[model samples]
Target: MLSDYFPSVGGQRAPDAELGATLRDFVAQQQGPISAHLRHRHTQTNEIGRCVALWPVLAHIAQESGGAALALLDVGSSAGLNLGVDAYTLCYHCGGASVHVGGAPRTDCRCCVASCVGSAARSMGCANLPVAGALSHRLGLDPMPVDVRDTDATRWLQACVWPCDLVRQQRLALALELARQHGWQVKQTGPSCIEAIHAWLDGLPSAVQPVVLNSWVLCYFSEQERARHEQAMIDLVRQRGVVWVSAETPSLRPTDMALPATPPHDSKGATLWCQVSHHAGEVRQRALAWSHPHGAWLQWLG
Candidate 1:
């Protein structure tokens, strides 16, 4: 709407909520003749601050769509490394199928969650005993896709991981490889994703349930632009019987205002996961949680 999602912040050095100038000073302090060639590395790693925050969103999609062939649109996906996360990893059983990757970092799963999984597997309704396979299937959409294979991009990708971000980076790398293996085309520069996604849906055949769609991209949009994009998505969901889920953290908590309510772009946005009919209708679910690819936890809204 305003040239780019950033509007016009001018050229002033923006203030970060955290990290401050530590990153700048850290690189400046380390120097050798070779260090002169690596000046830009600092800014690259500066981005890893809250990198892994996207996992819950991906996990939510897996549960809602279960097996739906989704056409994902990341509102402001940078380098699009997130899309690759789904492809390169696995879920381990015994302990309720925790995730594992050859070279990625790990997220400590709740032991209680694992116990529930084991119990469900042993339930009488589960006629197919001795489940031995891992959960699979993942998709993503990004307006800006970083070249996962580019040397600089890869290094930047590696640098962007946070101090304890072994799990995120490794998972992303695995996902990227899987995307290539499966031919998941990531569109780096496309028209407004709001419109593009609708058009793409037009070409899909009917009976595509859970037609799951989401936006993990707000950083790139101007206030009004984010609304337009979100509204466009909602309108489509209303027109076609499908769910529109969203998740955003409240920019500022509300007093006298309801908590864990339907998404409104005004506040920062919650880590929301919702659904709509895939065909003609106007039905939506505001309370839901992560339950996907594998039988993950399905906690309710707050």
Candidate 2:
């Protein structure tokens, strides 16, 4: 993101001619040790596109979970932007052919376009798609959660967007604005986010169904750590019903995990979307779609 946001790096076209070289130079010139900054900084790409792919699935789970308010636990939530999904509008362009629109919640600002819910539902092929209920408890768990209110932290969040993608940049700005308006609570997940899940869920009222979301987080963990986190989710289901949503690369998935169809990729890579349900003593996992990591578009597998 730095390469895109930093004036020195992105201002001149020549320096950005080769992305690898431009980043290397930028890192070398910084006064402090790069390692320390990397250790502390987390790319909280609270991507809106991801929500396009995820919202439908969330709606499905919410309906199945008795339609009460949710206690959302976001694992590896950098600035917890994803937690603000309900607050912003979503526009989905499928196959670069069809445009489906989804509305944001009611906002008082005049400049803010009142989000409406017609086209978005039509595009997803769900007539009565349920938007998530009021969040009784929204908690983000990250080793390094960015405080979106902080200027530096906010800039870092913007910097995480890809260079030259004006649409995504605008979406990021909107998501951040919504996050600022709605206060989101982020807690440290400690050494393992999986281990910390139980405590967070236990604290919420039983009426509020628990929904745990992780987007491209486990890839950062070692194989053993990944296994531990997966096991933790399974245990959460066996003990008490919960919904686990994940967006991950295929390689990080278990061998038994199935994709709705073979994944397609762009210049970036593949991101497979999945939803796991533990309802009525039955644990079920379904592959929903293949999408761009940041949710640029999605090909629904159903």
Candidate 3:
């Protein structure tokens, strides 16, 4: 279906008139199937481009932990593609200075290049970015987990991408291939994300540190639910020594988390990267950077 409509997937341009007619005819013939699919599946982009913004934060956490192996728990992980964060290469270019992370060779890797902006870009250099460390385990929590092994599930994941986004489509394909090779694990979660985290925490090895990650997920929750989730993160940091990494909108930031003196000028549609941890018995929250929702660029704040 995608191949018939999208030129990037089809290898030939489809005339606008024919495209509309074909779609209408197809919909009329397959109304039942289309409706069933829409009713059962939610849009799950599973964008791996987010890893460009995420790698720096993960590296920061690893460095703070004395290079301890991390056990990643990704909430709302669509196909668990971002679980292969350690496998891709990230190249950051800020004011003519460039830095690279990940073990994959440039040619054979799912490589992403991001630019930096704002006054903070002046001091940004290679030394400022921490090298990512090892991952002891990877797990995802989603109400409906997409299995890469399932043809229908993977196809639905592809259909979720915008037809015009060729770059993202190619990147997603690479990430899906990597996921199939790695066999990432995704567990079904109940209504409470905090409860799901608690269950997974007990099962992790003591030597590895637990890092909970959520990107653009809290927006789906109600106001009360968002507040509850924020409070739960603070409590987890103080009690269980867990770290919470979030990439969400500025409006969704926790009440106690201090904002930067001068927020990013281009923050209108940007995602705020943040880390919540405990230091000297106090729950500390730091705003790390401002980035494009799909990580096209980043403005380093910390």
Candidate 4:
């Protein structure tokens, strides 16, 4: 991790040091083992921050569907952190700006830490609805799912965090705790995972609505694979009406993918949000809002 070599701007071993040079020197030392490290380390950052923007859309869907229990299938869910989305509380500040804070940043620190915040709330229709008992079945699908109980795996997940961000780190700790308490399972996903999902959905009672979610996962797939997966979901919707939510980077999601015009951006960078429903061979897409990939904050356009 480049962050390990990064010295904080101030109050560090190398005060007034050039950041670029320090990073270069560290990279030089890590030259030969970079590939080996990459093979072992999955950049599977389960950005719990993303839930700030995701939860509202989820709640809205559940509420609109007559408050029916939901079966949430999270693809590329490393360690299943977001599977516990209903466990946490959200605090909205100044309309679009929402934050989720829990526990102390450090054992010695007394102040509460706000981990994730959306950039802006362009629309006010988003309500902080109750999440309790909203989810009946939670399935985490990943090619490689980390075992939260394994100390090594858990440590690696924490190491993936930006070295300087203690607030985010603390939030990760809390999310892990919640995941364990909730007993969320991380399962292997393959080409057959979709078929397995269909089987699972078929067995569920008519009352339970199915919701499929994935954040920054399709980028791992080739363009052809992504297209196939997208088509499969579209087909599935026609068979049984389902909800799909995705958060992707600009390269993967074109501005015109859902909406015709370009969306607005915040300080973090460009992220594209899409919510869709396909039924009776007709596909309807809602351009929810542009959000930070890590859910730092979001501008709610839905």
lDDT of 1 by residue, 127-229 (tens): 2112222223223455445555666666565555543434445544554454345554455546467555665567665645323344344545677766676
CA displacement after TM-score superposition, residue 87 of candidate 4 (Å): 0.7
- Specify the highest-lDDT model's number: 3
lDDT value for candidate 3?
0.75
Better of 2 and 3 by lDDT: 3
lDDT of 3 by residue, 1-302 (tens): 42565745764565566777777888898999999998987877787778777877788788889999998999988788788887776656545544333221122112234422111122324445666678888899987788888889888888888877777777777777778877889888877668889988999888998899988888888899888888888888889989999888887776777766434344466788889988887888898766777777665565
Point out the worst 10-residue segment of candidate 2 by lDDT.
Answer: 105-114
Clash number for each model = 29, 2, 0, 7
Model 3 misplacement above 4 A: 1-5, 11-23, 98-128, 261-268
Candidate 3 has a TM-score of: 0.83
Angstrom error at residue 111, model 1: 6.8
Better of 1 and 4 by lDDT: 4
Alpha-carbon local distance difference test for all models: 0.39, 0.66, 0.75, 0.66
Residue 47 in model 3: lDDT: 76
Query: Per the 3 Å backbone cut-off, how many clashing residue pairs does candidate 1 have?
Result: 29
The collision pairs in model 3 are none
lDDT of 3 at 48: 76
- Which regions of candidate 1 deviate over 4 angstroms? 1-140, 210-212, 250-258, 261-270, 276-281, 290-302
